[model samples]
Target: MACMEFTPEHRGTVRLEAREYGRSVLGAPLLYYPCRSACRLLVFAAIHGEEPETTFLLSRCLRAFDTNFEHVAFVLCANPDGATLGTRGNANGVDLNRNFATSNWNPAHVQSRSILESARDTLLSPGKAPGSEPETQALVALIESLKPESVIAMHSPIGCIDAPARTPLVERLQGTLNLPWKPDIGYPTPGSFGTWCSEHRVECITLELPRLAPELLFERYGESFARFLAAQD
Candidate 1:
């Protein structure tokens, strides 16, 4: 069943032992909550340090439960250094999401906007080489080891469910979140995790939460989202 009725005490009380997969540029441990049984899904948040909302919302959802889910592992924060520094990229100024060792990974600097409406005014490196960053390499290794049936990569502000294929999982997420499902985010993402998943034949779903404040987001979706996971199990 879904977690006991979520209460104020449960908001920050749910605990799970984290296994270290790797360390970040700042020596922060890359931690993941491993599932107790065979892993079928891996949910990760905060690949972009600037998007702490993703990490916050995922944490709130995970905290609703006291123990690990049987089929889902969790990465609460993929780029601790970036989150700490409040930069989109890691300490090395490389966007970790674009540092995956995929065929299309490139060394060219990437352009991102300051805000949703702003121009693409910021430039960041993809990395010295594909999988150059420790966080990227470690996450890749962990995913290969777990070999989950699907991965849910959390991001924010675009407010859509993005998957290359309109599979049932994506459809479910779209329906649950009341968001549109798109074939793409309408831009080229050369070295994204989604692209890497495609190369490895793994199903990936990008959940871009709406543009809402972290607490407000939790207030709106916390209970329903928790039940969604419980139903999955």
Candidate 2:
């Protein structure tokens, strides 16, 4: 992505510092900006490098919100390296997703995203260890600093909402979106934003959108979110 294509504000906060990791070859610099509301939402996309649709969706919604909401968040693309290469790992071949110190952290495959695979080929490996990748470290630090009340980890093609399952907000999300609330689908990811949020006691949504309908994502997810927020009020 051309960093210049984005206006100054879209380029992320000018005061925001740039962090590096994993040779810093494959990814673009991560960015963060403040929201208009006291409450904030952390939107992550392209965790799986193959799922580029979510990134576009997130970008669209963010620019749209910049025009519409008058309030949004520091939309951060957690792994620019992976996103650029269209691979699950960073330039160093580490599956930084699995690098988190979550309970299910994998030791072997974590060092190599290519080693681990699932039915749908979602690589659930971390790097040699949690917080290994600079990308991951930057994300962890951002999450810790922001301590957002709500979060949305964007993933794709599932078209459903999944979380810790026990969160009452899941039901509220289910009712609003008419999507099922599911358990942490056995794909154990240690130190992942989702699991990390659980540890921090933050209510989050792992919103899985269909890779095909990139345009309608905000409409679909936002409609549900708007309804959910209204109910909370």
Candidate 3:
């Protein structure tokens, strides 16, 4: 379910922007937390679109915002159509996560991304050029405008904080979720959200959890996640 699935009576803020993804029908739907303290953060989930699990967690967390940060924000469902179709890429086959303009990253353009190709396919098959997809462009616009202190990108199964270059905050996040101390061995992704955050010197934490039912996940990680966000300063 996208941010629009919530009603005005629901809570928080869901504002529609007139922004379009280039000349396509794709538009970035932004869900913001404008209420109120210290540092602000952006929570990005499901850049893959098929990982509705991340979206489910984010939807629950966004409504339960009581953290050290002055504010928290999310893209909600970055790839709406792909999400609706239960696929990994936008309708036009661009991976919004891999489509970002990065100086060191150049994903080879591949078409029609699914579970097999997913984010890599979009980079391998960048249509005309980088940031070509409406989804990619819209994401760029949103992130540039918000300029949050850090971005925690929610993903699945890895359960490690990937610092493309280096960051103490994200490194600490790995420690926060640890059952035992481990090294930050997350591999490098050239055109990924982690890379983007590393480039900007912002904390970009990629949360990896099991692909379980939302109810079960909440029961397991809700308290831990709250503690994680609270330790963000």
Candidate 4:
């Protein structure tokens, strides 16, 4: 197929062929852009609604492409309800990050700081049970189906890349984003996708974008990010 033209003028109009992986609690469509070829990487963003910038930046980078990825799949907004509601959690007030069915999956409420400088004032349910939410279940199913070698779970305003080990992929991301890499996020993430990936033996890299304005992030990383994905193809 001819690659779709994706100039800035076509940004709003250009659309990728997205498949419905599942639905949210409010019946919002859980969408994902499947790779056109073998899937090597599964990159997801905006699992937390409050960090819409992750979605925005990924969307912008995607808009630069005219065709499906040759080896990379994408989930621009993993938590549509939360993104729409401008909350960190989904419609059920569950932190989707903490809802994964991992060995450390905790039923206890997850505490998150509202602002970087603020205390952990916000509390959210992990879920009725691990992988209980439809979104979480669907994502797990998708990962199983795709069998990607690695996954990039995008988050924001933390200004660092979080991974268990400094794999080649992590090193490339560190160079691409020009951000420091951390062994962990400096806190316990009981049921995080990273933890789930570890148990499943799939590599997961949490790409925590810096605390930059949306436009600035795009301005600095947009083209470079597009080129990075293209390199994977």
Tell me, by lDDT, which candidate is best: 4
lDDT of 3 by residue, 67-125 (tens): 21345555656667778776677777666666666775575654433343256343334
lDDT by residue (tens digit), candidate 4, 30-103: 99999887789999999999999999988988886666877899999999999999999999999999999998
lDDT of 1 by residue, 53-74 (tens): 9988888888878888888889
Q: What TM-score does structure 3 among the candidates reach?
A: 0.70
Off by over 4 Å in 2: 1-27, 67-72, 110-125, 166-172, 216-233
RMSD of each: 1.1, 6.7, 6.3, 1.7
TM-score for candidate 2, please give it. Answer: 0.71
Alpha-carbon shift of residue 1 in model 1 (angstroms): 5.5
Clashing residue pairs in candidate 1 are: none
TM-score computed on alpha carbons, candidate 4: 0.96
Q: Is candidate 2 or candidate 4 better by TM-score?
A: 4
The stretch of ten residues in a row with the least summed lDDT in candidate 3 is: 14-23
Residue 81, candidate 2: how far off, in angstroms? 1.3
**lDDT per model vs. reference:** 0.89, 0.59, 0.57, 0.89
User: How many Å off is the CA of 161 in candidate 2?
Assistant: 1.0
Q: Lowest-lDDT window of 10 residues in candidate 2?
A: 63-72
